[model samples]
Target chain A: MIRIEDVSLRHGQTQILHDIWLTIPKGGITALVGPNGAGKSSLLSLIARLQPLQAGRISVDSFPVDTTPSRDLARILAILRQDSIVTSRLRVRELVGFGRFPHGRGRLTPDDYAIIDQSLQQFDLTDLSDRFIETLSGGQRQRALVAMAFAQGTDYLLLDEPLNNLDMFFARELMRSLRRIADENGKTIVIVLHDINQASAHADRIVAMKSGRIVADGTPSDLLTPKTLQAVFGFQMRVETFDDMPVVLHFR
Target chain B: MSIAATKQASKTGWVAGLTLAVLFVFSLCVGVDDMPIIRLFSDGRALELLLVSRLPRTLAAILTGAGLAIAGLIMQTLARNRYVEPSTAGTAQSAELGILLVTLLLPSASLLFKSLAASAAALLGTSLFLMTAHRLPPTQPFLVPLFGLVYGGVIGAAVTFVAWQADLLQYLSVWTNGDFSGVLRGRYELLWLGALMVVVAWMVADRLTIMALGRDASIGLGLDHARMLQLGLIIVSVISALSVVVVGMIPFVGLVVPNIVSRLMGDNMRGTLPTVAVSGAILVLGCDILGRLIRYPYEIPVGTVMGCVGGLIFLWLLFRRPSHV
Candidate 1:
């Protein structure tokens, strides 16, 4: 379990997240949904220790996040942010090979290569493994990045809006892939998602936030109601159930 | 591709290694004094100059070239942009300023003292660059290097002004030339420290690589982003500052060698550092040899030859539409 207690953050004088408390249970897909400036990314950063904590405690699997050795932390958790820009011309396989860095320290043994190859196949990037990352399109590049994270072999995977800039088909495919990884591999996945329906369809649990505070947290079926949507997004939306999942119609 | 083609592609390093070795031997032979090859070892004065002076200078050039190239690779990786290097990004100028200040203040300061001052100054400049980067809105990351160039140019102009007024322009020119002539046995020992830094850099290469991805990603992976970056900057400053101290400012050696090596051998630091070292050695040695050949007895400085040739090569590398991905 990932537990956050009284986490507060201030950028200069402006408060970003205030006295936030959250708990993400193990072995499932949890989607964090919020509007812009809602501190979803900030909270993720704090949990992952990407940014230093100003005033809170975070623990991953009972170990305090702040005190754990980075290599130890890397073993348990892997994070993929929205923007991963690598300027060097690295082939897709080489990029995925970096997933083994925390474990092998850049000298990959046979086991590391096996894990890398498996990750490439899992992400359906086996065909493009030899291609350079710069040559790949947006969706392909995102897959390559996801493949790398998967290759990390961490139990807890944190993705900050992994679907940004992906087209409709690729977005659904990626969501499906994440769902499979979480279900089949039994990995605990925490993803920040913009599309409410994607969260509703794929997420086992949905945590809604606004103004840096978690207003609601429950199963997607329980949390994706029109009332909660109105409260969280400040918008009136119609909701319908398809395949036993709540789909919010906010487009019109 | 055919079997021969595949084998050829895989042997890029070997080809580069052979070329560098050949060039090194040629560089050893070519110099201001055209003593016969057999007499080089027998003649006492010639032997002393060649073995002690020329040999050290050549080794200094090789080490400086390697250190600078790796430093550039680190900086470019950290910044996540091409077209950025320590010299172009102002780190070298800041180091030079530090050296100039210490020299002016304490004329009797040892070379080590000057190097420390230069390292400190380079560190300060790099910190300023990073802090300033945080406040600005996101755009092309290349803006960092552009700003660095402008910043470096301002400091470089100031250095020139100071040198002119102090009637130390000749002294300043010597530092700017990237020459290997003055490097002797005792004076050039400082370069061994840079080789140690390269080793340290390799040990921390994993951390540096992750940090290069993005601040958030590195943090998510639980790496101390700030400390890693600070460490990288420290490495870069020490290498650039010491390179300047040893053989003036040999401009594009840093930019050209790493880019070439990264393109050829993958970007992994473990795989590429050796190639970068060899390629840097070859480039500098070739330039040094060319400098000797062009002017003969006059002995043009290695810096001028490198700048002229390296500038043209850099332009070609930048504009050649980049064949390799």
Candidate 2:
């Protein structure tokens, strides 16, 4: 479990995340959904230790995020930020191979190579593995980045807006892959998602945030109601049922 | 295809190694003294010149070239901007400042003492540049080199002012002009420190490449990003300072060689380091030879030749479409 208690972040005079208390259990997909500037990414960054915690405690499994060594945290958790810019010219396979650095320290063993190959295959990048990352399309590069995070073989994965720039098909495919990984591998996935329907159809639980506080937290069935959507996004939304799942229709 | 790629890279490495070897022989042969190939064995004076003067000069040229190239590669990787090198980033200027200070304080200081002082100053200057770079917004990549140039100009002005006041301006110019004409066995042994740094760089090549992936990605991969960056900066400083103190600042060997090698072999540091080093040596050797031949006995400084060549190449690189991922 990842436990975040009384977590608050302040940048100068503005509060980014205010007293965020949330517990994310192990071995399932939990989606964080919110409107623009809702502090969803900030909260995720705090949990991943990408940003330092100013006023609270966060722990993954049993290790404290603040004091734990980064290598130990890396083994337990891997995070992929949204605006990751790879400045070097690297092949797709080479980028994925870097995910194993925590284990191999840049010298990949045969076992590490197997894991890398598995990650490439998992992300459907086996064919493009040899290609340079700069040559890939935006969505393909995004997949490659995710594959790199996956190749770290961590038990917990924290992704901040991984669906950005992805087309509908690739987006759904990525979500499905996340769902499968969660179910089969028992990896805990905490993803910040922009699309409510994606959370509705895939995420086991949805946490809604607005103006730096958690407004709602429950299963998709309980949290995807029109009333809740309005409270979170400050706009009217229509929630309809499809295949026994609530599909939110916010667009006019 | 992967096998073929590796084979092709090795082939390129071999070709580069061969070129360096040929240049080494030519560099040993082309000098003021007529030391023919056979006379190296028969004549004592010829052998003495070859060992004490010619050989050291050639080694100094090669080591300075290769060391600065490696230093430039590390700097570019750490800065995540191709335009930042020792010359542009104020490393050379800071080193020259260190030499100036030492000459003022300890007028008769040994070469080792001078090198130590210069390396310390280089480290300080590089660290300041890195700290400033960290504060700047990442929106503009070009701003990095510009900041470096302005920063270097300030340091250069300071050194010049001090040297001019002390009436050591002529001495300072000789130091900064980067000619190996004065290199002899004892005077050039300090360059071996640079060679050791090159070995250290190779040992940590993987970490340096990881650094090029940016701070978040590297930290995400469990790398001690801050520590690795510090190590890289130190390596760059030591090599840059040593090169400046020994042969003066060989302009653009670091910037051009690494960029060219990256264009051909990609940025996997493990696979590209040897090629980068060899190419650096080759470029300096070729330029040094040209410098020797251009005026025969009088000889232009290698720094002047490289500045012209490196400036043109840098302009071409600036106008070309960026290939960074």
Off by over 4 Å in 1: B1-10, B39-46, B133-137, B322-325
Q: How close is candidate 2 to the true structure, as a TM-score?
A: 0.98
Error of 2 at B235 (Å): 0.6
Model 2 chain B worst lDDT run, 10 consecutive residues: B316-325
Q: Which of the numbered candidates is closest to the native, going by highest TM-score?
A: 2
Model 1 lDDT tens row, B223-317: 67778888888898899889877778788888888776766555656556677777887888888888878867667778888888889888888
For candidate 2, the chain B TM-score comes to: 0.97
Please report, as a residue range, the 10-residue window in candidate 2 chain A with the lowest summed lDDT: A44-53
Global local distance difference test of model 2? 0.89
Q: What TM-score fits each model?
A: 0.92, 0.98
- CAPRI-wise, candidate 1 is medium
Q: Tell me the lDDT of model 1 at B220.
A: 56
The alpha-carbon RMSD values of the candidates against the true structure, listed in the order shown, are 2.8, 1.4
